[model samples]
Target: MPKPAIFWDPAGLELDSLGSNSYLRSTDGDTPYVSLSIRMLSVDTPETHYPGRSKPARSDEKLAELASWIQEGAAPIDDGLAAHLQPKLETGRAGTLHGEQGEAAHEHFERLVEEKLTKPSGRKRRVYLKSGNEPFDRYGRLLAYMAPNYTRAERDEMTPLESASFNLLMVASGWAASFIIFPSLPKHSDLCLFQEEGRKAVEDGLGAWSDPLTLTGYEFRMCVKLHTVTKELMQGKKLSKAERLRWIDRYCCDMSTRGVYSPQDYYRVPAYDRIFIWKKDVNEAVARLNLSPEV
Candidate 1:
């Protein structure tokens, strides 16, 4: 059962009410509650933190530039973004735009919260959560999609678009891009709706999409991973392919080409077409989503 808890951020990443008022669980003694970290499903906002406060992306500086790393034999994330970020690095602005756009995305999401999840009385509205098949992400954040909790009357009065999940609303609002992953994939109809909203968001250049050079939150994480990997390689650490892939998450399906692509190819796949999958799940996803294997 869901509990009333304070959301710490617009992305629904974590909750601040760590004790009595918390998400997911209550201890047998009832004095404390387990803190739940949630990685919201179906959408990803821009890269928000540098010198980050958490793990996975524990900041080692946003190594958005690919030239030196590429010169060191590291693969380029994507040609255009590589060039786009290169100057920023050369001119000492490498991580600035990433952080700026992240703030922009967060502020945009707050506006979305007010518009989509606020009540007429100015209280925060209720929401329903739909989780993915796998409940916990690698970072231990619970994965979910928060939908507006509406009465039948309210549902009847609103259009499907208006009655969207907060996940969808984020995409529609233009701050978040469509971020579907395998096995956790929504129903086909919902996926189509996500694509439509994403199309509009991109076309309108809303939020992160407005900044042509902005990396999707996922891509930012990947670049950081690559940098980390390159760092280890630079130190001559002996790492297996699997061990190397463990932290650098970029595996996915390319919808346009109907093929699976590894993390390095992630930037080539557009947000709407990219279906992120953990490295281990790529085989299962191929069978489940019916896409071709990596070429």
Candidate 2:
């Protein structure tokens, strides 16, 4: 019998673009680029491809206030454990935010990927993509909590987001937002961890949080063109009758009469590229319409 395919591999790795968050992989020893886009799970960075406009400067007082918020928002722990774990929890504090700081983050990520995964200098390093439950995002991107530190057993034991996740690092360093699109998904555990990191970033006044003009995650997502479908879904707005019907046909959308179902019950809807509706939002839509599940 053949051995199980290992999750981490260092073979045939090539990074295409750091700005768009894409890379190439060939674990099967085939040609790379077979996987076009590999998204860092649970976070979204500002557009390095298009740096739109200047953001306002954040006040020093504001930064201090934000940092304090992070320390307070940390999850509750036993007093005995809290004192000991406090230093470890602070590990995430020493990070750099992506777009907020400069285009440096894109270059930083590229360099990190090269050093950790592609470097053939000594013993080649292995990178792992932990596809916690929901393997693909609605955009068809391979949604994964990436671990360049997979070789470290202690890091592997930590939750992917809590460990050395390229995704969470972006958020922790203030490079990205804790963009929790599908809150009800199995990756919620990872999301929670990323959220904590994001709070730390905010508290530390890292990245976009330091920019007065930079929007909060909710505000930014609502305004971004990439998140149109998500904004519409969350705001209880409909594009058209036909569009609604199509969504129903594709994603089992019974928005007219909120239906209750597990988030796991739904799969990727083929019709839409990056459309996603939270299970609770769908249920609320269903109840709002007072329509039966059949609708």
Candidate 3:
């Protein structure tokens, strides 16, 4: 009973037998530009070469076989019959055998990039104003939210337009985070409100957070963390009072400022109950305001 033969898709490479000096062609019509053989350099012994088989070999199996052969110090001969075959031999020894697997993974990664690029916007635009300068207001909010500790000089260094854009992006990230963290909270509607507010903030010449790339990156992490928290919450596992307070504080800070802090910061600032208070205010505001458009 011979083992079932497995095959790999050889994109464009060939392997020869141990003794016969014959050219082997890959099933995909790819002919290697070289021939390989096993030889005893001490004596003028006849070289053995394996002609390429009609079908591809399984990648795993091919790797195993290649590993065994390399251990035997096989010499490769280029089809061009060049002076040396060191490059090809080195390539084989380095395990460059699975072209098909590489191709498949590349395709999958490309699809993911395409999906991200094609995401659609689902909210109405709204503008907010502050200090007779919409851009400034938006930027102020963004800086306050994102890099609160930044000095006035830092804020002044940014152009009004840039600040507004940054703030809008920060708002977008917050809305995106909410969707992932609380899927049941009418995400579409919240997004609409967020967009409207962001636009208003921008139009009023208020500084708005700009920088979709940064916001997207932050949202990516937030979504992952939110999923973990949501699953734990749904499990009916009671969080300790301290744990619940910590989560509340963290969520508040993230929502209000789009800022994240380490666990050490959370413990150090137990005195700053403003986060807890602000969280309650925001929750109440969301509840009172019919922000979600009826689906």
| Candidate of highest lDDT | 1
How many angstroms is residue 103 displaced in model 2 relative to the true structure, after the best TM-score fit? 2.9
- Output the lDDT of residue 250, model 3: 27
Cα deviation of 271, candidate 1, in Å = 1.6
What is the alpha-carbon RMSD of candidate 1 to the true structure? 8.2
| Per-residue accuracy of model 2 over 1-295 as CA lDDT, tens digit each | 9988877776543444333554566566665544446777656665443213533122222223333333564322224323332332233321112234446456667766666564345666667776745565555666677766444665656666545667767777776666544422325355455556766877777866675344433222222321233335446775664442222221233222334333222222111111235544655545543534431
How well does model 3 score by local distance difference test?
A: 0.29
Task: Give the per-residue lDDT digits (tens) of candidate 3, residues 175-252.
Answer: 211111211122334334444554453334332122221112222222223333434544666666554334223232
lDDT at position 94, candidate 3? 18
Evaluated against the true structure, the overall lDDT of model 2 is 0.45
Query: lDDT of all predictions, in order shown?
Result: 0.69, 0.45, 0.29
RMSD of 2: 16.2
Residues 163-264 of candidate 1: C-alpha lDDT, one tens digit per residue: 988888888878887888877887777787888888888888887777665666765665666677767776788888766665556477876677887666
Task: Order the candidate numbers by lDDT, best to worst.
Answer: 1, 2, 3
What is the overall TM-score of model 2 with all chains considered together?
0.45
Q: What is the Cα-based lDDT of residue 41 in candidate 1?
A: 91
TM-score against truth, every candidate: 0.76, 0.45, 0.18
The worst-scoring run of ten residues by lDDT in candidate 2 lies at: 266-275
